[model samples]
Target: MRNRTKSVLESIVIAAILLVLAQTFLEDFAVLIGWSWNIRKILLFTGFFFDLFFTGEFLARLYTSVYNGRSARYFFAERGWVDLLASIPLLLLSSGPAVLALLTGGAAVFALGGMLNVLKVVKAVRIARILRLLRVLKLFKQIKYTNSIMAQRHVAKITAMTVSLFVMLLFGGSLVVSMLGLPSVDQVIADRHSQTVERIVSEMPAESREARNWLAEMTDSSDLLLVKRDGTTLFSRFDNRYYTELFGPSDYQYIPREGYDFFFDMRTLGAIQSKDNLIFFVIIVVFVLFLLIYYSPHFALTVTDPIQVMRKGIEDDSYNLEVRIPGRYEDDDVYRLADAYNRVFLPMKDRSRGTTEARSSLLDFDDVKGLLDGE
Candidate 1:
């Protein structure tokens, strides 16, 4: 009953972990698909809370293991290292520097010229979330200790392979994406501003006053600074005094412009990233599916089927009979197991049979002596 309760609790933990893992991946995917701000915020907070919870869990397990003098077994055999890595507060860690930079007016981060590059590298730490997949190992362990038909070596191996394949593809694909280098925030902003300027230029009126009126009707008044080709300001919506303070003379200017240059506001860049990252999105879906589908049947045939057959043979009292392994699998571990069992079982069965026959033949001597005495 105690074991059953423990199993039930552990099962609940695994289920919760699956949900958290899903949320973690979804948070990353949301960025590439331009999910809503509210949804992203919810995922972010959920991740933070779960990270804290897992950290506490790791600490509790660590203390318990140490108290029991089984620290090494817990850390190595029980995968404590995986728990430690997966329990890291990824959302908080990634957000820490950005928050500090903002609080310090960017000096805390940008004081050094290469600090921006360092921050970009820090963003990749989110990929460590993949380590959480290793928690599936505990599920296999749980199955082994419980009364489940699926509690077998093959099931454990398959679970390991599935988790390993997923982690490898996700981490490797994410690394590739990072190596290719996604567009920077500044670059995205500049490209959008240029496009908007070109479109507005083609439609603006020749007269400055009419152009100003049209611009006011079409765009945000505070964001545009329309100017003629000859260096004359045409329709300046910027506050002239603060404009000089905020922007340098050549800031946001377009090259070889005929009509005007417009100023655009900085906004969140998720939509642009989503559009540019379609290839990675497709790779994530297609590559994982292809590998899983390709390997499923192979696992069924080579691993699970052999284990099932061996188990059935033992249960049916067929240990003395040779396990009929396939010719091709003669070199495999399963074949060796069957061969070993047959070699030992046949000899033991023959010895037992001989002993039984000798006992039956000799047992009549005592009875014969007693009958002679009675006569």
Candidate 2:
């Protein structure tokens, strides 16, 4: 189980990384190719795949809980609820303010559900399956060879830490993007401003002075300026205040063109670039810390636990086959070692007991012999 969990976690991390990379590169390609809809479809499919995997994982967890005599119904119901809610985007594409309102409301609910799922994953840490690959990889170590029981315990600890670290990094990244980068806020503002300018331009009469004046008003408020087909600045009254504040100077010289053209601050196009690099660094540091925490407990539980159990069992002489190391003893190698020790010790204990009985008998016989001699 520990191995299985580890494999799944690793796969998830890899998939997430791939998804991020794809989004970064493909978006630009789509834009250049004028296939933006195709890009959206690809993103939708990726999301669907993620949803499917999450559902499967949730169900597997639920099954484990059921087998372990815990109530699985609650988890199943909650996961099902999330799936139902997430399915909304699959069907609905209503336009206008209503769609926006629905999406906003759904986003809040989805966030809550996602948080709950995260908590569930954390709670399930105790039962996470150990990764088989990690166990096999550890076999290369010559000096500090762990028994099967200890290996299994370590595997579980590693799996838990991996999942925890991933969750932490994911949330941390989101927090940074939200608070500092403000990508969503920026997007919203940009959308609203663009729509407002488009509307104003559409309402303006062709080649009219009033149209030019309205465009000039918008240019004052925003960095965007309207240009005519004859390479004339429609909004000659435009003050590029925002552009100057953002970028040192306007690099593009606007010649009066034949058709209307829009100009704005180009530097603000990819503002999240720096934030992304910072987030990457932070995630790497957090992951390293997680690894340290994961392996530190192995010294106590992996080495000490089995030895203590063996000592206790040997001293008792009762030979409790049920006596087990306190930590997770699921690793095959550790289990075999424990079995070997038990095999060696149990017979030794029996022989010692028999020898003690024989000695007592000999002492009794000697005492009888002495009595006979005295007679």
Candidate 3:
């Protein structure tokens, strides 16, 4: 029962890993593919579900190891570290600081701004899940169940190739896409500034005092300057900064409203376009994943099934000249091997029987002759 439970959980984990891989590769193009934004939420939910499941599995194993007084074995020998990694939703870890920054305001906002940059770097740590993909090697280990050594080798080799191909397409394609699709640093900064402008303008407070308070609450007090068309300052917040640095910095946006032109410096905004222009790569990955999954079983069957059948028949004493394997074609290597085996085996069996019968006949004649002499 325990083994059955383990098998079921392992199967679920494998399925989850595949789903996560598909989700990760295809997520960037979700909009292009006509999937609603809600798809992202669903994916996130499922991702959390799988993470929780893996975490529970890891804890269960840890508990069992502790009970057996071999907790070190679970951590080191059994790769519990992998389970721990696979379990963690590192992307979710940023939410705490984000919430705190939003609720607390001021210095916490700056801290969140720095953390946002750090999380951009944290996104790369997700590639570490590639190590978790190594868990899929368990599928190769299952090939050992095949009776034929040759069949096991063939299946394992192809399985490894298939896995390597999928991973290469996933990670390598993502890398190429990232390199090609990434915007220039200046472009990114400009985009972030534009986004910040848009957000602040859309959420601009109606009353002057309210607007000033909102601006102060949202970012550094001096980050925004509101000046009239006649160059008279209406609502200006200035702090310890040089006029040269504040006035003509490239990372600022200007918007002309009814009474005033607003100048806002981009000190609060983080990366707003982290993943864009990946539709082409997403399509390639989906197609490759589909093709691999669709044909892999057929390929494995073609390569391994014939050898397994022949080996099993030989073990069962069912393959011979009289009852040979029936699927022989000129181009079929496995059937040709069966044909060769039958020819050699039946000829050897016939030769051994013939020699034994001849020796028995000679002995029978000698015994008869000796009996007559005694008579």
Candidate 4:
């Protein structure tokens, strides 16, 4: 009989890992693409949940394997190591910086936005979060067929490919971030004094000629000038104080409009330079989809048939000449598993073919020995 408890726990682990990988970058993604802040709550909740669940699951499995005499194999097994990388590193990476931020009292995380050089260690370890992709393989461990298939030599090859994908993703994401997140050299610092002038004018008392004069006195001369749309000057933060002395009449222009009113137009927009990054995004997405499609079909053909044959042997409580699976792929794991399975069962099937002693075989269920050997 299948262990339902183990199966359900494995399924939950798979679900949590999927949630973490899917939602991990959502906050940064929203900022990059300028999405609404409404999605931040959903992203934060899922991120916290998946990190906690994976951390607990990893600890439980680590302790159980150690206590159960499989400590070396548990930590060294393909599945075991992948689970370790996918869970613990992610838990620490997501939480450590946050804890440090809280302990140091109300600053942004990531060493309060990379303030401390020592905590740059967190940046180096952040790379391991990419290994969380390996958690996808854990879902297979619940299915005996897919589990065995993934445990084969192909694991090394898949790990290499996953690492390569990680590199490409990081490169592409960094390119996008430079374009969307970083400040340009020519970007202007908005005039803070203009904001003060707007607030003072809007909140002026019912009577006071001195109110408007005080606004001019309070603001600095190289700051932004506030002007009405009809060419009437409201106040000169710059032009009235230092007009034509440090500035030319041709240097400034009155732009008509909203809140902050008028401002300088100095900028070196990098939009044109980042055109290739968008193209790279499309290419990488298509490349990943192609890789998935190429390998997925091999699972159905190589894994399902052999496992079904073995499962039926246990379910029916007897072996028979019928339903024997022939090996088709010599290099594949399923072929090896099925070949071993056929060797064990073919002898039993042969003895039954010549006898009407099947009831005796049913009574002697203990004959099933070494069935899981070498799996």
Q: Please report the candidate that would top lDDT against the real structure.
A: 1
lDDT, candidate 1, 1-375, per-residue tens: 999987796787787676764764576577655555456656656766677777777888899899999999988766676667667544344333434544575565456427545434343544455555555454444443322344344445555556557666876776666667767554556566676677667887877688777777766633345555466666566666655444322123333466444544332343333333334434433543443445444554555655666575455432445566677877888777767756775567557666664233424577789788998
Q: Tens digits of per-residue lDDT for model 2 on 209-275?
A: 7777767665666545445634555654335563343222111222222255655432233234324
lDDT score for residue 287 of model 2? 49
Which number leads on TM-score?
1
Q: Which pairs in model 3 have colliding backbones?
A: none
What are the per-model numbers of colliding residue pairs?
Answer: 0, 21, 0, 0
* Predictions in order: lDDT: 0.57, 0.44, 0.50, 0.49
* Per-residue accuracy of model 4 over 1-375 as CA lDDT, tens digit each: 368988786677667655654565453354345343345435544655676777777778889988998978877764576667667766665444444444464255534446543223333333344444455455434334334454333533464356446644764564454346454221223234345446554664433455446545655443445534235445555554444342222123334355324543111111211233233333434444443454544554566556766777645545543334444576577677666666766566656656754454454445555554535
Candidate 1: pairs in clash: none
RMSD of 3: 14.3
Candidate 3, residue 369: the lDDT equals 88
3 or 4, greater by lDDT = 3
Rank order (by lDDT, best first) = 1, 3, 4, 2
The whole-model C-alpha lDDT of candidate 3 against the native structure comes to: 0.50
Question: After TM-score superposition, what is the CA distance of residue 261 in candidate 2 from its true location, in Å?
Answer: 13
TM-score of 1: 0.51
- Tens-place lDDT per residue, model 3, 1-375, is 999988897787667666755654454344334343355435545545555665676688788899999989867645565455445533234223333333464246446447554324223333333433433443344323545555545445554556556645655654554456566443465465566566666785866677667766665634564433347554556643543332322123466655557776533221122133243334434544453455444444555555555565455432333323445343467657756656775566557666665232224576688799988
